[model samples]
Target: MACMQLLLLLCLLVSLCNCYRMFGRFSRIPPEPQSDSAVQDQWFEQKLDHFRGADTRVWKQRFYVNDSFTHSDGPVFLMIGGEGSANPAWMTHGTWITFAEKMGALCLLLEHRFYGKSHPTKDLSVDNLRYLSSRQALADLAHFQTVMTEKLGLGKRKWIVFGGSYPGCLAAWYRLKFPHLAHAAVASSAPVQAKLNFSEYLDVVQSSLARNDSDCPNKFKVASATLIQLLNFVENYEKITSDFRLCQPLEINTKMDRAFFLDTIAEYIMDVVQYNNDNREFEGVKTTNITIQVVCGIMANESWGSPYDRYVEVIRTILKATGEKCIEASYKKYVEEMRSSCWEGPAASGGRQWMYQTCTEFGYFQSSDSSSQPFSGFPLSYHVQQCTDIYGNEFNLAMITGAIQQTVENYGGLNIESSRIVFPNGLIDPWHALGINTSLGTDIVAIPMQDAAHCADMYPARPEEPFVLPAVRKLVYELLTKWLQL
Candidate 1:
């Protein structure tokens, strides 16, 4: 009896840990801690293998419900959870919940499997991870929808799906794969086509910065060239290590070292630009309410110096703004940690799960181009090599290329002929280049929100938000209304 009780307590603790991870994904502003009982609200339990045999292994799936505005025969607003743990915050906040309330519709936020508390297997080994595909996830949703509706006796209620970012891709794909489950979808920043080379990402970053200050892009370009040239010499490399305050000396001999070093800098720049909101804080950083203009202003204040000197000064300024201590950059640390074996590492399951998805289906590797771009160190080959390192020799360039082609063929890519799926992306979001930016069919529409960041329309209405974001939300509502009418 004692052993059984202890086991049950351990299970309960793991369940609580799942709830905590929901806050882990978005650490910009700390959310209030909820008790286990509070976390239990509206959560459901379902079998792990919705497609496979009757193994009867059950896991709890976290979700939030709002029936206050829902009529017995009203529409169902289903917001699909993304890569991380699903939080009730989305159900309570966000435009989707508000829109559901306006339409007197049932609002439900379903967490994805292998995320939140919905773990399928006891371990996340590569072999076990075979069940963690998007196809399997969608199947889980189909089962969940069927079971939930039957349990609630919600018959013939039209269901409209909603998602943002990677979940936005899931939302659109779910509608395409399972038309019987969802009437329509609202995909914000959804990258429909999967590709191995995504050089256009940096192009947008350059453009976003140029829009802030035309000189900014040129300055960045010059700095990049200087860094690339310095990597050629041992003494210059040592100087760079000292100047940048890197915790680990970059092994220039190793090809991955060079690629990882440059990729890290590019990622930092992308984050600041991607979350370019003056009202909100960037995730896990001291940087609060920043824009590209602010970054340029910091660079502009410095005296004109050698390319190498200018590069060091600009990086230091940017790092300080983003809450880094500047005592250590740790290029090797960043690369080794990221490229560490996901099978037996301290990295979270959510990250590993996403990496697996990228390895198998979406090879959206953002590499530097032949042009004078800031991240000139990274080539398309680096990303291809990363896939091989992560998943093994089987996932080579040929395999990845085949997967990308298969994805485009299977899902219709950006040219999908699906209807009633309103695709919206921000002009400022780098991911917009991969997303649908034009209408494919009469019912399908793509609205580009001006002066907006990633998934800008998905957030709750804020006073400081750009005018175009709220307008996009209104358009989404209008689209939803039209879809339901049919």
Candidate 2:
């Protein structure tokens, strides 16, 4: 389940691009717990609107810089921040620090606009969210890089952009959109495609679990069948809701409520499978070496109890694994909050900001369309309804569909043809299916880490690190070095 925690973390960072919405599933509110602050806090005055004319409003953009490993003539490693608060711990403990030190490079971590302390407006209203986009954020990176270079007196130093998950997508696109700005780019687990009804995501989850234990997928299928049967009967709904300790009884009026219930289970499984990191605790929860295998074994054991009972136990187990217990399970409550939540005034609204992105640009909703898919109850309609509730008349299937098509056409969609970028994805990462998994050009490379989890290569190295990660990092360094030489 450690991998799930990593997935949750990745969602906070990567979901801003596509992949999945961080708080869209269940009541998994509150951003993943961050590590201790290690880097100095600093802010840059940035323009409110990068493209639109005559918007002179300036906002404080949060960033952190580390020049300890830099040399006057060495390269600069820019760690692109994603959809969450910019944690300085990355500066001290992330793999970029190690790579930067190895290359004697300066490291700078810049938070994306509307995320963390980098707010361009007072709130996350629709008007404010109009300015929150990849285009503007990419512009922010370019402008910030130029300013930092001048401020630090680094003249024409080679700049290497580095990021994992969503920022990773940005890193690769920066090279494509602003080719001259980045010498090379390392985009680890970057999901470049903006998809609607991203059922392929669940496919990766199923495949990863089955790879660990072949019987695991069958066991999961049985559990899902049991839940589907149980939930289909209105009489069983109240009992099942109580079993899951839902704050309220499950509603039978709409398919959305049932799908929400099933998604809690689906989200838990997806979270653990993608983030299955063995060596360390994640977000203060204990993570096993083979979490999916262990959970599958437990769920498959018939001697313990009935399949439905065992499934219930598995749900409880997953909740406990994340250091959380029974939560409010009302889909209606979620919709009500989504509609009434204030994105204005003070406080950082990460979830609201990202939801707007999903509504506008990338409808990467993780819904299931097949019986083989675990969360089969969550059809694409559930996602559309959620979007409608959030954005009112401004959001709909037609509008979201248009945005998806435009995003794909403009950025190469699933077929990103950018060069001078190294795209590394873990086979187990569900988001890998949405990214560029094969090289389409001479300078564009895609390396799949066989047993690695989401963005495993981007984290700080550990004694228990997978063998392929170091190999991939070495390749990334070689690529960057080769690019610099040219």
Candidate 3:
């Protein structure tokens, strides 16, 4: 659900911060598309339903291409966009573009159907969203590939795919499902295995923070314990709300609201740790790289007062950074925003669409079910309820489990047997838990990278980045070159 302007506007609209998973996967602030002569924006007439022969509905899917460094017979490098709108800059920049330049490959960035300006549906109604799934998206890629083959005179040209996060899953799955259509794939920080309750996400977060030589885990445990103890008392709600500087009175009438409150609070550290430090830039005045070290530093500062006081500061710090007016912890408001069937406004962040995907296809519900996690108030039940509230009563726990199971079965989960595919996973990224971690001979392989978080390798190589990235990225290039024969 988190893949955004790529993410800033989406985050501001969806969670008033980093847009959950995918947005962070792409960016926190959406960078404007820099005008480049080599980059050309284009649209393709994509099928609304790939399976239904009778369904003749079609929509214009947006995509971009960059031919700056491409030779006539160079390989094709397609960078698939996930939940976020495909940034045209992706055609001109990013690690994929770097590879394209090196390999004399043409770069293409394809926007997902429901995201960005690609309107497969006029609205976000449940009935209309039936067509939104990974299967259909993969089909979209196939259709695009066929079109590109004819349009660009790429009849015998080999195609290699690049994707991060949800798009990463697509890249790997695309190679698996359409082996004839693709030559290879590079999936970065991708969670291929479908899960109903992603408690490991939290576990990974805890491990990420603790492994960073930061006292954040201990500080969070004390802070969360104190807050949880206080929140249990109905009388302390008012003081807690006022102290936290919430936009509205804390909602505790139902258990869902309570869970939402914890979810909102936990997201502060969750997003920070998830993103960590990655070399992402936009034409903004500035952007704060909120890493785990920054958060751990905050938690360890005794000058901030008690652990609870430090926790409050963390929220304030994040709010100020993201330019949000106040802490929005109201569960009803979140539901109200998500329930809107309109295509514009806040829901346009692809939040509703991604939320629907979570409900129907990939159940990436980051739940606080494990007591091992500091953020423990929010349970898996809240995730189910959130889905039900946005969609309908039909999206219950049973339905969610079935949907997740179906996705896992469809893709063969982590056991996907595909050749010429590279899984570059960052140990720090929680999503890496679901991605493959071993090599299958010389073709299908996983490159486990330490200190890399989210899609760190997808970004252009930076001198200041973790030392392991350069080596891992080189290994990926060696594998890719061996396979692509470029």
Candidate 4:
């Protein structure tokens, strides 16, 4: 009876699996049609849907063409999103999308693979995830170009790719990889080099604290000290423990916990930076409460309690825009791995393994860019060497730097001049955008946005109007137009 019951359960599970596979195969949204007659019609706005690749994975795509279309006017504008996002929510709802609609040109938003409704594979490992690389992403845009020209029968219509941040990097790469495909490309806040160095970002935080002088120094100091202490505890676990027993949860004062404190400082800084750079005392007293809420929310949630949590959150926001859910399960699994392996062995016996395993919980630390030699041009390796030399192997600075550098380099390189790529950065960015001082004969366009944090664009309330707004937009737009023409 027991054997029969098990066989029935197995059969049911197989049936359910088969049903899911079949459902996924037919779930894709179909591309809209473009009327050939409308190609010459300037007042015809239409959306298109079609399958481009041979693979059965027929991912859905949307094309918003203006009311008027003429092959004589040349290439249509294609918007690419940054980082793990499919499309910018702001663009879809804000002035950008409206501008595209008014321009009377085809505005194509291509969702990146593995994001939104475009899951390209069943497995999401580091190996299979290689498809998520910049090269493959560029290929997606190229495929769209072919579709627009050949399948859609839109004769001689050029494409102009535009994006900011990650998409900005993509725009530059698209121009480089497929020069003939696009007539023009515009990238904003483009990050072209790969590597992560937090020292400069740390310095930014310190400077901000000094400038504010708003009791935030205490919080910053506490957080920094806690991080160092945590590193020390992990490094000396074997020395302190006899048989590698799990230690009791370290009781931390909620008000003083480093993570909470850091979040508070970051929130205040971002609030100030995002709004018009008003150093005026924040009117709301809830800033501290909000910071505590953010910190506690991340820590209490099993999925968000890791060092790379910030990056993961950002990635999630981007992916969510495209209707993708890739990280939730992975995050849970990571937490389980850490919980199960804590203090399982001596520092020398299993410390490295434990650290690597737990570190993987943070998605931002994973990068494919590395060199066998110590001093290669790779910024990730350089930062890793610096960290390991100072703090030792207990904390894998290599992993952190490797992840940061790869993402930046893969998505951020902008070749403005024949001999140089300028990387303009605000002083207060935590991403350490200033850490990369030089790369591949590229000129660094490092602009220090006074009292700015993260991306300079985040500071909308800069005192200087002409220097901030028009300058940024014109520089990015002109660079893309010129690069595409070249």
Query: Which number leads on TM-score?
Result: 3
The whole-model lDDT of each prediction reads 0.71, 0.74, 0.79, 0.38
**Candidate 2 local Cα displacement, residue 48, angstroms:** 1.1
Candidate 1 per-residue lDDT over residues 1-486, each given as its tens digit:
543454444343232222222121111222222334323446677677767676777777777777878997679988887676566656556788788778889988888877655666665656777777777777777878999999999999999999887888888988998898899999988888888788888888888888867888777777777788888888877777777766456567688877777766556566667767633321222554556777666556556475556657656766666545433233334333334333323233355566667778888777886473555888889878876776678979898888778888888888886778989988988889889998887778899989988888887677888888777888889989888888
Which ranges in model 2 have alpha carbons more than 4 Å from their true place?
Answer: 1-38, 278-290, 340-349
Residue pairs with colliding backbones in model 1 are 247-330
**On residues 290-323, what C-alpha lDDT tens digit does candidate 2 reach at each position?**
4776678777788868766776777677656544
Query: After superposing candidate 4, which stretches have Cα over 4 Å from the reference?
Result: 1-75, 83-104, 152-154, 196-198, 208-219, 222-334, 337-427, 432-467, 474-486
Question: In candidate 2, how many Å is residue 338 off?
Answer: 2.8
Of candidate 2, the 10-residue stretch with the lowest lDDT total is 13-22
lDDT, residue 97, model 3: 74
TM-score of 1: 0.85
TM-score of each: 0.85, 0.90, 0.92, 0.49
Please name the candidate that would achieve the greatest lDDT relative to the true structure: 3
Off by over 4 Å in 3: 1-40, 283-288
Q: Which stretches of candidate 1 lie over 4 Å from their true place?
A: 1-43, 47-58, 236-239, 278-288, 304-345, 370-372
How many backbone clashes does every candidate have? 1, 6, 6, 29
